[model samples]
Target: MNYTYYGMFLWLPSVLSEKGYSLVHSLGYVLVMTLAQVPGYLTAAWLVERWGRKKTLVTAMILAAVAALLFGLANSTAMLIVCGLFLSYFMLAAFAGTYIFTVEQFPTVARATGMGWAAGFGRIGSALAPFITGWLLGVHLGYGWIFGLFFAILLVGFVIVVTLGYETRGKDIH
Candidate 1:
């Protein structure tokens, strides 16, 4: 979702215009969201160490999903920007945690390979997401459906991480 959102939001100004927002409004939300991401990255780095990887990952994932949903449902500009800020924060935090967790999941033998595969998969999604998102929005299904899809996708990722993940905060990577 992090990567997808990066691509998806590149056209955010237009997307918001579709929802009856001005270009200035769209820029405001995107700008604030960008600023919000910094704290998420910093806090995730701290939480991954203090709270452990799995916990931080799951929490951020959940927050991201909720925020995406809210962003989709928002009727007003203020609500939209607020929700987007939160969505950006948690999504970036999840991204950071995912990176650390993916690295920790592999042993020395295939650490590089595992990291490469994981990032490659993310890139593929990022590459494909714009088309899919454009289609979803093009259908005029509204922000609710488009953002709902994002919410569901993030939830699926959350489930996969939780189901397949193990706690690795203190474990020595060899």
Candidate 2:
């Protein structure tokens, strides 16, 4: 899941370039993406307290799907940038919430280990995403199709979280 989230950012620049955008445009798009995540981090902190971890994660996944789809459909560079911002926002929210959720799911003795493993596995996904995106791009799949694939992956993540995830609201961490 974390892998998929990080994968989106990994391939974002390549996707932009495939669309005929310059390096400056890609960098600016990245800035927009990063800036959009700030609010999500704060919102995740609050939403986890108010609604609980499960709901927050589920909601973030849904938003990720919407953002991903919009990103794939965006016709212009500006529209793509806007979708990128929205994608970053929800992805960050989901990412942070998962950390909190994972930690809460384990006992103290193994909590750190579990969280570490989860994070590590997510990084593997992140690592693979760039390669996959590059391969697809090399084959001339186009930015729109690449983003469409991302949206599909995010949708799967949402379903996984909703079906297999647990509620961890008001639980003692220790």
Candidate 3:
């Protein structure tokens, strides 16, 4: 998740520019995509309460994957913006749910440590994304290949959550 999310933030402007948009226009598009995060976070917050953490996260991941695929294939400006908005929304929503869910997975005594380690490991993914994205672009791999790779990663995350995650929606923290 962080892989794709961070990749987008680091490379979206470059991607846009490569598509022939000017620097200012690329930035504007990224800004519009980023603005979608607010509602995304809010929606996740609400869904976590209504649908629980695991479900919300899984839903976000799946939607994000689809958005990534579409964003890669988008040729027109309108499609690009719409796909970018969806990608940003679902990815940020997943982040919100993940933070809440990770904390819930640990008891009070180890919660901070668990969160810290989870975050630290997640940052590893974050750290790798930019370099990987840069390399892929440098190699002249198109958006299709780049985003297709992320699409697979997001699906792997979704599977991990479904198979390994437990519900913590209403249960009391230990």
TM-score of every candidate relative to the true structure: 0.95, 0.88, 0.96
The order by descending lDDT is 3, 1, 2
TM-score of 1: 0.95
lDDT of 2 by residue, 10-112 (tens): 7677677767888888878888788989998889978998989989888887888788878878898788878888888888898778878778878899988
Q: Which is the leading candidate under lDDT?
A: 3
What is each predicted model's overall lDDT from 0 to 1?
Answer: 0.85, 0.80, 0.93
Better of 1 and 2 by lDDT: 1
Worst 10-residue lDDT window for candidate 1 reads: 2-11
Model 1, position 164: C-alpha lDDT score? 95
Q: Cα deviation in Å at residue 102, candidate 3?
A: 1.1
- Tens-digit lDDT track of model 1 for 6-117: 5457657778888877788778768887898999989999999999999999999989999988988998878888998898899889988998998888999999999999
TM-score, model 3 to reference: 0.96
lDDT of 3: 0.93
